[model samples]
Target: MTSIWDPIRIGRMALAHRFAMAPMTRSRAQADGAPGPLAAEYYAQRAGFGLIITEGVQPSDDGQGYLNTPGIYTEAHVAGWRRVTDAVHARGGHLFMQLMHAGRMAHPDNTPHHRQPVAPSAIAPGQTMFTAAGLQEIPEPRALSTDEVEATVRDFVHAARQAIAAGADGVEIHAANGYLIQQFFASNANRRTDRYGGPIENRMRFAIEVARAVSEAIGPERTGLRISPGSTLGGIDEGPEGPALYRRLVPALAELDLAYLHVAQGGNEALLGEIRRLWPNALLVARGGRPLERAAADVEAGLADVAPVARWALANPDFVERYRRGAPLNEADPATFYGGGAHGYTDYPTFGRALVAA
Candidate 1:
């Protein structure tokens, strides 16, 4: 049986266990899009995980969606993240920074410059996003020109290099959750007739180019990509061709021999099985809303190389220790899941501390 505590290796990075902390958007950055002061302590607290994937970090100023989300495109951002990586490394933890480009999902009110968000087409997602004034409807985004699209790919490459400079072990491209990359994939969001929007191959061009550029800038062994096929989040409509699209996308990514492929499972066992078969190496599955036991079963059954957990990792800093000891876990409070101070972010008590108090 493959225990969750068993050591594993993904590409060039060696992990102490078969479990990882999934990338989650916490909206805890500073006003300037730099990581908050408590970011180091917050991540260091959860160093017990085999790998710690940081929250969604924008690749450029215009990529920001929610208020106070971090960015890796600036010097200050790199400095702030250096502290986080240093803290995690001191405790023998590996870290991967997730690079996200929000595209049409962004609200101008949430950005410091208040610039209009850009996407593959000039369509709005018909969804609401949290801003300084609270939840507001997303506005129609500006469609990127071919030149601009190329620039955005460069931006991802630059951000990947910055992540490595900031002491991160690798970078996970956030092509999931209806972000910029997914926007190009979904037919409802992308109406362009150009090479970027017509066919499934055209729609996948941006994501593939971005991945290739990032991998070239910072070795393929240090690059990871996260995707959620057929996800309806953020008003995405990939149409019925979603599975076929991923069938083409996954293998192209696999050929790059990237660090790992992180798939956010959406209850499609057949699709997941196909992806697993296509890419037999370094697969990390994120089964949200499922029990840790299921994740464990996945590893034991050789269905997944590792399982990424979000809520449990958030509430239990020493999650692996607690699971090993069979101790009860602290429930994550939804109210404090996003922007907030250390209360719910870093105050979750470890089992040893709880026992000490008892």
Candidate 2:
């Protein structure tokens, strides 16, 4: 049986282990959406994983949904991220900047210039988002015209380019987690009658176009995507037809031959296996709340190429070595998970270093 510490080949790079750091929003960046001084140290401390997916970063101001989340659209943002990537690479780690457009999941108070949120449709999620002024109710989003929709695709392309300029190893387009792309897939949030709405094919067209644009901008080998087929966060409901919709989307994405496909599924072994079958010849990453044992089983069974653990990676900087030695793992602090300083982000001690302190 292949262990989690086994070396694996993902994309164009050979990873030292199978464990990956799943992207989680830390909300520690500067108010201008640029990474702060501690960003590099935070990532550098957890460079043991085979790959690290950074937090959801907006591709444009319209994509800013949460307060203090980072961005890669501007030159300064690019420079800030370059420092982060440089630090991670110095530790022999690979990083991918997640290009996330929040779509309707935005509060004007959270963004610079307080721009209104936009989506495939004008409908709102009837939810609230964290802002500098506290949690504010999400306002109605403006519907994007066809031309504007195309422009959004271009925005993703530009963001991917910026990520490359920022010294990132690659880019992961965020199409999951109840964000803008997934919002279009949900029947409740998307009520448009245009090419971006209605049946699954039409709704999926926008996502495919966006991915194609990014893949074209950067080589397909350096581009990846994340998806959650049945997620209903932020007042989204794709209905009972959710699974079928993803059935089609997977093959379409596979056709592009992008770097890999990272799937976030809670359980659904059958679904994971189905996606693995459809996405043949591409690297598959399965990320959910599964335990290490289950994740290893998935990888051993060829259901996934890698298993990503978010909170585990956050709390255990030496997660790979701990897993290898069967050492006791440290519990993560929930309070400091978001919008915190270096306490929880970079303070996790490695097993060897912790033993030395002991």
4-41: candidate 2 lDDT, tens digit per residue: 56687767779977778899998898977899789999
> Residue 228 lDDT in model 1?
95
Q: How big is the positional error of residue 302 in model 1, measured in Å on the Cα after superposition?
A: 1.7
Cand. 1 Cα-lDDT: 0.91
Q: Which segments of candidate 1 are over 4 A away from where they belong? A: none
In order, what lDDT does every prediction score? Answer: 0.91, 0.86
Whose lDDT is greatest here? 1
lDDT string for model 1 (191-285, tens) is: 99889998999999999999999999999989999999989888999999999999999999988889899999887889998999999578998
The 10 consecutive residues of candidate 1 with the worst lDDT sum are: 291-300
Model 1 / residue 282 / CA error / Å: 0.4
Please give the lDDT score for candidate 2. Answer: 0.86
